[model samples]
Target: MVLIGYWLIEKLFTFEAYKTRNNRGFIIRQITHHKTKQEKERQREKLINMEKRVLYGLVVMLMYLVGGGYSQGVVEWIRDKAEWEEILVKTEIHIGVMVTSPLCGAPCDIVNDQVARFVETYGDRIKFYKINVLETLFFALDYKILTVPTVIIFKEGTINLRFESLSDWGMFYELLVNSSILDFPPDLSPAPAPAPSDSDPDADLPPPLQSGE
Candidate 1:
């Protein structure tokens, strides 16, 4: 939801670019004290509409994902709090999961589509999970999550990093990279024996003791 929101916002800014990329002409007009109040209002109106589309688009995309089309096996979905807790304590390396919603807009949709590749690449380093805010509302309330695509990186059940809104695939990449903080357990094999000494073993024996006696 967060990722798509940002993408939509980016798209909206470009949706109404004035004549050119910079819109420097508008700036020049403003500097010269030219009469351009109507243009200002137009831009404002565009901004307003952009916001509306962002919200609406998010809802539409979320609905589509809730159905069977959402990519499965990309990341394990947490069905209940028991499952969430089990993963937290049992996993040795660290934990990373996303808190999202069924109603989340384009940002969540974008993350849903793009995150599978990173998961496949880094799935060995650490396991990734997704918690539905609607199904598991307790986790969301516990984490104080009000937005979709919030990511929590934790180790041994302790949170290390938290992203309030995941607005792009980069966040997923970062999560995978950081999950390796506690990589595979150290090797536990015994040490090798030392090399044999070169000196004679009986050199210091009682060869001279008999004569002295």
Candidate 2:
């Protein structure tokens, strides 16, 4: 009877130890799974950031290439028109308009290209100013320009005509030309005549023999 009792106690203790070991193994597996999940999440986040950085770099490079490829004249012309507006012979055009974007798109590019061409061709006679919607929010609101490609014609610095969307280029040019703000010939003071040439051989000739004999 004593031996049987000792054997029973030993069996119970062994079973308890086995259960404890199993429970410890389960816990370890759970922890390992959680750690692996965390590592994967971190890796995914890193990949997303790397992709964004690469995309940003590509966009920057594209901008540089486009900017660098344009002819010097085109580049200079763009700069002059953009920067010289303040100093430009403030020509009050019968047409002034606010453009909302500088981005490249179907109709946007078409409209912008036309405007740039107009500015380059008749810039001396008329002034066309463009302000980006994102950059010049205040100016847009001040002019009540709520949409892109808005055309506004100004005379004496006050709004006179406005149109949204594309329209006939000829009509716009005509309006600008007749605005009277643009000095038709551009008031250029005449340059003083070159001083009578000092090498003139005619000046030294004795007064023509008072009319032929």
Candidate 3:
């Protein structure tokens, strides 16, 4: 059988012999000192065990590549696409903030922070979703997003407001209030200035009463 012949060949020529000499020297050495029956059998078993381990490792690697790169990758892509499609179809108040990258700049950070606060304040009334323009190009194209740090608000599946560029939290709050999405207006009043302190060392001290009150 092919396996028997292959095993015989391996027993006759091993890695140790290959490292030591040319083909002529290897043949002469093999002929001069033929291994004992027990030694030959032990070498054959060792080679077979090594071959099995290598074959097993290759099979496991192949399975992992197929499962993770092909199967799971496709499944996740479909799921995410479906979720975004559903968001577009649903008739609800939804706010989508489009950004090129989450950690790109101060503008992106400010927009995210404002949206997060808005969501926390009115989460029960509206839904908020953050869309990365680079990662979700299809969604960005569908929504016609042309710039980073863009905020789009939808009411009953219609775009109610769209804002672009960096903006302060007060501006966003005012916009949401104007759109009537928020029931109550956000307090945009400037913080009161602290009263002047009497701790200044250079201040004119009251003239000491000249030894009498």
The clash count of every prediction, one per candidate, is 7, 4, 0
lDDT of 1 by residue, 68-144 (tens): 44354368789988887788889876567777787766666556554555566555555678888888987987788
Off by over 4 Å in 2: 1-97, 102-104, 166-183, 187-213
Full-model lDDT, candidate 1: 0.68
Clashing pairs in 2: 95-153, 96-152, 96-153, 97-152
Task: Give the TM-score (vs. native) of candidate 2.
Answer: 0.38
Each model's Cα RMSD: 20.0, 17.6, 21.1
Q: Candidate 3 — worst ten consecutive residues by lDDT sum?
A: 69-78
Error of 1 at 101 (Å): 1.3
Q: Which ten residues in a row have the lowest lDDT in candidate 1?
A: 165-174
Model 1 residue 14 CA deviation (Å) reads 54
RMSD of 3: 21.1
- Could you tell which candidate, 1 or 2, scores higher by TM-score? 1
Reference-based lDDT, residue 60, model 2: 43
Candidate 2 has its poorest 10 consecutive residues by lDDT at: 69-78
Instruction: Write one digit per residue (lDDT tens) for candidate 2, span 180-207.
Output: 5455565579888766558885775568
lDDT scores in order: 0.68, 0.57, 0.60
- For candidate 3, write residues 160-207 as lDDT tens digits: 777875434325645654566765555789999876567884455566
TM-score, per-candidate, Cα-based: 0.52, 0.38, 0.43
